[model samples]
Every structure is written in structure tokens, then in C-alpha cells.
Target: MSEFKQLSRSVQGLSVLVTGAASGMGRATARVFADEGAHVAVTDVSADGAKLVADEIGASGATARAWALDVGDASAIDRVVGEVAAHFGGLDIIVNNAGISVRVAIDDPAYEDAWARGIAVMLTAHPRIIRAALPYLRKSPCPRIVNIASTEALGATALHSPYSAAKGGVTSLTRSLAVELGREGITVNCICPGPIRTAITERIPEEHKIIYAKRRTALGRYGDPEEVAHMTLSLCLPAASFLTGAVIPVDGGLMARNA
Candidate 1:
């Protein structure tokens, strides 16, 4: 294998499927997996962006493919999982990284939509992806699932209660899935990212941006999406066979101190 392919194939020859793979953490994680020797399928709601990521992976000499999906739809998740598995022979890793941000104040009627949409994408849809991938993942010698969560789930953040609540559900699901799948050789874990400098955080108002940049944040600034992605890959790799049900926070120590 070429150097790029050598780095891309961790767990020997397993396949990984990452949702929201068009950009940010999803795109970064997909690249990391490709470097580690795994054939990676990148999925996103953005068809063009997904195609771009697939192209980048393929250029590196890794097997790559793309699918545009609306994760909230169970049938869509099922169809995509099947497609990725069919492309790569089977599924061994899944990263539930796609999520929508909801920002609404008390007086805003949009709060209701934000709450509902946030939950649908962040919490409800993840298990549906796992359910669809389970049969194939179970067949792998090393099966793993990584759910992208948020530090908001652990601590109170003004104006983001709904988003935090949705991530809290993700945190819970990680533990539950781990216990259920551990016997079958699948490990499940979560990454609680701090306010990462994704498009979502870039849009935050300058005034309140500091609310997420308090002394509690040891890193002193918002984390880059790839930084969070690197943390994610560590947990999802097949060499991490002994780790499961872990909630590893990539928050720059935001959760280590009292607010």
C-alpha cells in the first residue's frame, strides 16, 4: 500500500461511514480514516460537497464514495448504510457527526422549530443509522460507533438549552448502545466538542461570543473542526477495541471547572 493508503487503513481492512461528511468534523474524520487505510463513504445533505470529499479521498488512493442523505429520515439512513456497505463489502465503523444548530431566544417562535429540528438531527436519527448498520458492523472483527455530542450537554449555556438537551440524548444513547453492542464486539463512544470554529460558531454574535470563551476554556479560543475530528478518530479506530461507552470531551477543558 502507498503511504497515504497505509495510514488510511486502520483495523486492517474495515470500512467506515461518516454522516455530515461534506464539511467540518465529518469531512475531517473521513479524511483521517482514509489516511489510516479504511475505505470511507462520506454522506451529507449536500450532494456537491459530499462529492467533493469523495473526490479528495479518491485522489489519495483510498476507496471513496458519497451519498446525499437527510438523516432524520429512517429509510434514508437505512438505504445509505446499505449502499456504503455494498460499496466496501461491509461496514465496521460509523461516525454519527451530522447535526443542525438551533439558536432561538425565549420570545422567538422559532424556538419550537429549533428544538424539534435539533432533536431530530442530533439525537433521534443516530440510532436509526446504527440500527441499519448493525448487521454488517456485527460481522466485522472490530466494530465501532462514535456519536458527536457537545459540551453544552454537560453544562448550562445561555440561549442553547434545546441544543444541549438534544446532545444530552446523544450522550445517553452512546452509553446504552455500548452496553448492548459490547458483547457483539462493537464499541460505542461519544465526543463532546466545545464551541468549535465551524460555520455554526462563526455566525455567533460578537457580543455573546465571549460567553463561550470564558477562563473555563483552557485552550483560550474556539477549537478547529479538524482538532475535534482528530479526537474523534482516536476513539473510533479499531485499535481502540478495549474502549467503549466513553464520553470523551474535546472541549479544551471547558468542562473541567465550574461556570
Candidate 2:
């Protein structure tokens, strides 16, 4: 067999679970893994959206299943992890890509509640899900965990204090987990994305969009979801075995500019 073909077969039969796989970067990441021959568990808060993505993968002759997941709920996280692992025989990879961004100023009346929820889902859920999946991950010869953080984790931005704090926590968590799990043969890493063109960004006002498009990234354009997905796929490969505790950015030179 050709070398590329042989390498492509490496992930075959390996099971992957991507949270928030219904749309955006999560969906793109799930699709990339499935396309590369992994049996993927596509999960999201939106059952219909998750099922649709799963069905699409299955239709394309890949193994995939849809599951409802509300990452902020501890019990729901536990239940989904257990069920997906059981169905897949054991979990080999986990992508903690589920997150929400609430952009309210600290002085706003709704700030406290929004901040709490954002932290719960974006920061707290990462470790919770990892702890639940540890047993299953321990069984795999090449286990991996990819936490989806944001560029906000690296710096401050107006109207995004809560999200920044939560993602910063995620980055810290990724580093700690990588060290703790290294000896167990599991590699944990974080991907910090910036200004990706996703459903979330579509809500920005047109004038704000133009300004962000021009100034936020060095590339002077927003990135595509698939671009982030490809970066994610790179980290999941066997060739990335030496990489862990790494806080890599998929931003279009945004973080670099900040540096």
C-alpha cells in the first residue's frame, strides 16, 4: 500500500468523541476525524443538529452516532461519556469543543449570571469530561485530548471578560492535564482559535464585522472553520506523539501580532 494510504489507515477503528459537534469548529473537527477513518461520536446540545451531522457521516460510509450533550450539566456529561465509550468499545480521542460566549460588560445587570454560565460550560466542563473519560482513555494505546480554547485566553478584549477568564482557565487545565497524563500515554493539548467565520460570528453587526475583519487578524480576513479543523487533525495524528501541554493557536497571526 502507498505510504499515505497506510498512514490514513492508522486511525481506522479508533473511536473519537467531539462535543458540540453540531456546528462550527466542532462540526468541522468531527467531520475531519470521521473522514480520516475514525469512528466518531458526534455530540451537541442540539439533538437534531447532532443527528444530522452523524447521519451525514454514516451516509458517507463512516461510523458515527449522534448524542445529546449539555456540557454544563455534570450528570449529562457523565452519562454521555459513559454511553459513547460503551458504544465505541472504548474512547481513543476526545475533543472538548463545546463552549459559549456571553459578551456582557461587568456593570451590566446580566453579567453575573452570564459569566457563571460561561465559566461552567467553557472552563469547568473541560476537566469534568476529561475525568469521566480517563478510564476509557487509559485503555487506548494512543489516547489524545484536544481542548478547544480561544485567542481570548491569551489576552484581554472588551466585553469578553468572562469568556477570556474561562478560556484562560482552559489553557491552564490543558497544561496540567498534559503533565498528569503524560506517563499514562495520553497527550493533552489546547487549540486557541481566533476570528473564525462561524455561526457565532455571524451575529456581529455589519459595521463591527468590517472593523474586526480589517483589524483583529494580521491576515486581514476571518478564518474558515475547516482551517481550524485541519490544525486539529494535525495534533491528533500519531506523528504528534511528542506534543503535549502545547498551547497552539490556529489564529491567523492574531496572537503573534499581540506578541
Candidate 3:
């Protein structure tokens, strides 16, 4: 029994929906899910980028598709959730990886504006997806929902108020939902990553990036896309089924340091 458990592909033949699938952690996660024999539907604001990933998955003979979606719109989220569920018969997993970042100081007057925009995409949109998919997820034997967050959920960022606040909401929402949905067989958890190289992080001033590399992380290095992708797969598996409402940090020992 233990050997069979060790060799089992927990996600094989499951249908997965991954947001922000055009690039960064989301893209990496989508590919990883497909590699594990899950049919994946990739969604992002970038149609071209999402289509490119879908095409790659298709070329590998995996079931995949892409949709251009603005996570800010609840109706749009509902539409895509319904579409994916209908396409795949039922949605066994939902990876809420779509998010937006805004660079603004905490003391800035425009912080409210920046924070609102970030919330629209990062924090607000995820519930729309869960609400829309609850029916389909309830039908599945094993249901998983993974929300991608950031180290900013724990550490403060002077120049990233909006991004930090949004991610903080994600961390909170994960715990809240876990308590509410645990008995229903839907597992909810958040992965708070630190200093991942992505399109959004490239905009960070190099000097500041290096400073971040030096200060926050003990390893003094940024994590790779694959590392975060592995975390995503781990969260949705049956082993993690009993692990709900936990904030799993995949950062390279960043949370351990007092400095």
C-alpha cells in the first residue's frame, strides 16, 4: 500500500484551471500540471502568451487551452470557470495564480489607487472563481484550490504597498476558506514565495533588487520558476489534502532569518 501510494500520480487525469498562465509562476505551474497528466486551461490577460503555452502543451499531446481573462471582472471569472468545467466535465483543481503588482511607497498619496488595482486582480478575483466553481468542485472526488501569494504577506515592502496588501489578503483568504470548506473535501492553502524572477519583478530597480537579494533572503539569491511550480503541484496532491489553511513558504530560507 505504501509503495502504491509512493508511485501514484495523484493528479493524473484530473482537470486543472490555472490563472496567470501566460508567464512566471503561473506559466511554470500550468506546464507542470500538464506534465502530470492533468488537462489544463490557462488563463491570462495576454492572449498571445497564454496561447503560446497552450500550444506547447498541445504539441506534447496534453489536453490544454488558453483564455484571455481580466481577473478583475467577476463575470469574466465566472464565465471562464464555467467554460473550463464544461469543457473538462468537472474541475478537480483551481490554481489561483493570477495577480498584479503595483510599485508605490506606503506613504505615497496614490497608494490607495495602486492598492485598489492590485486587490481587484489578486485578492478580489479569486473568490469569484471559487464561488463559480464550487458546484463542479463538489462533484469531484478530490478538490484542490491553491492561491499563489508572496513573502510580502509577511515582510513589509516600502515600495510595494499595493502588491503587499493584495498578497496579504490572499494569505488571509486561504486560511478563512480552509476553515469554511474543509468538511466539504475542498482543500485551500496559500504559497507565499519570495523574490521570484518574473516579468513584474524585472521592473524593480537593479540596485534595489540586489539590496532585496542581500537583505531579506539569507540565501541571497532569487528562486527559480520551477521551484515554485513544484510547490504548486505539492499543494494540490492528496498528501496535502489534510494540510489546509496553512501558509507554506517556498522561499529559500527567507522566513528563517531575523534580519
Candidate 4:
């Protein structure tokens, strides 16, 4: 009889770096990973917010550290990824969740700036980070990458061309890298969240949010950041080895409806 090869479901003791982790989905993803015993690098443009999340996790007896990172800066991506790997011994997973929301018309003067900024932070940062972390990730038995795309990648709304374009790029990047990295045992996946209750959506009026949720989502509500984070966690698991190139929707059925 052939012996069974067991795979691990736990992320305990693994090193994880989460970008834009100062608040919203990034914060939730860091916390979830820390709670499960991973050493988390909570990095964000807002240093104070990242520290707060790291401190909160430390207070709970979990492992975490904070770093100020601007994903749009290519040099910063290399520096921070290296520092996080040094601090945690090695990096096994990277969650490219940093983002900016750009809502501008195509003819608007600000549209060009919005598009450039959106692409820099969201689409471009993914490969830069993964490239920086490749050396360390290669040393690990399980290496994973999770890129946070959006439902807007699958469908779109008016006035969000820049944001949608960047997200669409992320999904494509996820697939291309998944194929390229598969031979190395590095799993790359994407999560397309829909109507998530994050800082970006917080500005919308409560009534308007509720109305939109009811009209658009199948579940009739917005999803919490932790809900999206959990899916990110699942994809990084060693047990999910065969799940590369998957563009999963953690959208509470947002993409499942047509009417």
C-alpha cells in the first residue's frame, strides 16, 4: 500500500506580510493570520495604524510587527519585504492588499493622475513584492501569494474606470503568475470582494449603502472585512496546494446575480 502524504491546514509559525494592513481588509487579514499563530508583518502607509494593529495582536500574545510601507514605491517594497523576512526569519506568504480608490470621469483632469496612482499601488505592487520575496519564499516548503482584487474586476460601475482597470489588471496578473510560479510550488490566487464594509465604503451614507446592498447583492448586505480575510487565509494554507490560479469571489453572492 502507498503511504499517505499529509498536508497542513494550520499557518502556525509561518511568516506573513500583509500590505495596507493598517485598517479595513488588510488589518483583518493580519489579525486573522496572527490569531492562528503566524508571525505577521502589518505594513501600511499609515504607520500609526499599522502599529496599532500590531500592538493589538501583541497584546493578545500573538506575534506581529508594524512597518510603514507605501506599495506604490518600488524601493519601499523591496526594503520592507527584506526587513520583514529578516525579522521573521523567512517569509512564506504575502498578501498584496494595498489599494487606493479612484473615482474620476475619463474626461476629468484628475483622471490621469487617478489612473496612474491606482495602477501603481494596486496592480504594479503585486509583482514587485512577490519578486522581492521570491528568494525567501523559495526556501519555504509552502509559499503562497494572495492578491486582493475586487468584484469590479468582473463587472464595473460608472466613474470608477481607474479603480476597475487596476483591479482587472490584478486578476490577470494573478493568473499569469500562478501559471509561471506553479512549477516552483508557489500558489498565487486572487480574491474579488464585493460590497465589503471597509474604509472605502464607510463614506457612503448608511441608507444608501443599505439600498445598494439590497439592490445589488444576493445576500442583501455588505460583508465584513474579516469574512474576506478568512478566504485569504484559506488560500495560503498548505492544504490548498492544488488551488492555484483560482480567482475566488468572497462576495456573498454579489457576482452570482443577474437581475
Query: TM per model?
Result: 0.90, 0.93, 0.92, 0.98
Scored by TM-score, the top model is 4
lDDT tens readout by residue for model 3, 8-113: 4478899999999999999999999999899999999999999999999999988899988888888888898899998988999999999876888778889788
Residue 71 in model 2: lDDT = 93
For model 1, residues 1-259, the per-residue Cα lDDT tens digits are 6565332225546798999999888899898888878888999999999999999989989878999998988889989999889888999889999988777785788888888888888899899999999999879877889999998888867888788899999999999989988888899999999878776776788656566676568766678888987877788665687889999889888887565
For candidate 2, what is the TM-score? 0.93
lDDT (Cα atoms) of all candidates against the true structure = 0.85, 0.90, 0.89, 0.94
Mind giving the per-residue lDDT tens digits that candidate 4 earns over 55-172? 9999999999999999999999999999999999999999999998889999998888898999999899999999999999999988999999999999999999989999999999
Model 2, 7-36: lDDT tens per residue?
A: 332677789999999999999988889999
TM-score ranking, best first: 4, 2, 3, 1
Q: How many steric overlaps does candidate 4 have? A: 0
Off by over 4 Å in 2: 1-9, 205-210
Q: In model 3, how large is the Cα lDDT of residue 227?
A: 95
What's the residue-level lDDT of 115 in candidate 4? 89
lDDT of 3: 0.89
- Name the regions of candidate 4 deviating beyond 4 angstroms: 1-5
- Give the winner by lDDT: 4
Order of candidates by lDDT, top first? 4, 2, 3, 1
TM-score of 1: 0.90
